[model samples]
Target: MKIAIIGAGNMGGSIARGLAKGSLIDDSDIIVSNPSAGKLEKLKKEFPGISVTNNNAEAATGADIVILAVKPWFIEPVMRELKLKSKQILISVAAGISFEELAHYVVAPEMAMFRLIPNTAISELESMTLVAARNTNDEQDKFILRLFSEMGTVMLIPEDKIAAATALASCGIAYVLKYVQA
Candidate 1:
């Protein structure tokens, strides 16, 4: 499946890099885009098989799965440019954006949107990633779970628990760092 990562920062880039390195997806099948030319350029050099771009819409154009990896504050702006096809699954690692709210922009009746909470430990392949499905079928849900499984163990949780999961895994990454610093 063709995959697009909309934000090629620490988390997104790390996921792409890990996927390619692990042979979970062919580097040629993966696409990455970021606002920063420097990061995109770096990504190009780091993963030569993946196409890196600055256009969010272009990055997501033909993607079967699009990862909305932008920061929480930037989700609205980024989501504006992304047009998720009905077959496309929009997975956001962004904290706090719920599935119901995310479906507002989804034009596809079969649009499969999800919220995930993955800790920084994913870089080390040790993350308790929380996943939630919205308007997704069993087949699609299993497919998504399989994809995330490449990064680490995945758990399908209730939509209500996504927030705490986000707090514990997403924002909590920084919180844990603070303790390490202390």
Candidate 2:
């Protein structure tokens, strides 16, 4: 399956690298897009098989899954610009954007969408990734769970509990780090 990552920043770059190291999908099937060329160039150097682009729309065009790894503030604008198809799966890694807000941003509010909260440990392929789905079937849910499970432990949770899960799995990692340092 073709996967498009919009934003070659830390999270996006890390996900690309992790996927490249995994067996779920081929590196050649992954496409990463970012406005700045430097990060894209760095990712290309690290994973030559993966494709890179400066155009978000181009990256997302034929992709089966589109991951939004941009900052929370950019989510709305980026979603607007992509004009994603209802058939494509949307996964947002940006924190603080709820399903309700995301629904307003997309062309099809009932499209299969997911909110993923992965901690910094995803860089090492050992994150606690919280996933919440909307308008998705069992098969789609299982596919996403298995896809992300390659990078880390995955928990399928209710949309209402996303904030709490985010705090425990995402912010809690920092707390653990501080305790370890102490």
Every model: Cα RMSD to truth? 1.8, 1.3
Candidate 2, residue 6: lDDT: 97
- How well is each residue in 1-182 modelled by candidate 2, as lDDT tens digits? 99999998878998888888878989999999999999999999988999999999999999999999999999988988999999999999998898899999889999999999886567678978889999999999999999989999999999899888888876777799899999
Judged by whole-model lDDT over C-alpha atoms, candidate 2 comes out at 0.91
- Which candidate has the highest lDDT of all? 2
The most accurate candidate by TM-score is: 2
What would the TM-score be for candidate 2 when compared with the true structure? 0.95
Model 1 vs. true fold: TM: 0.90
Q: How many angstroms is residue 118 displaced in model 2 relative to the true structure, after the best TM-score fit?
A: 1.2
lDDT of 1 at 166: 72
Error of 2 at 54 (Å): 1.1
Instruction: State how far residue 20 of model 2 sits from its true place (Å).
Output: 1.1
- Clashing pairs for model 2 are none
Give the local distance difference test score of model 1.
0.81
lDDT of each: 0.81, 0.91
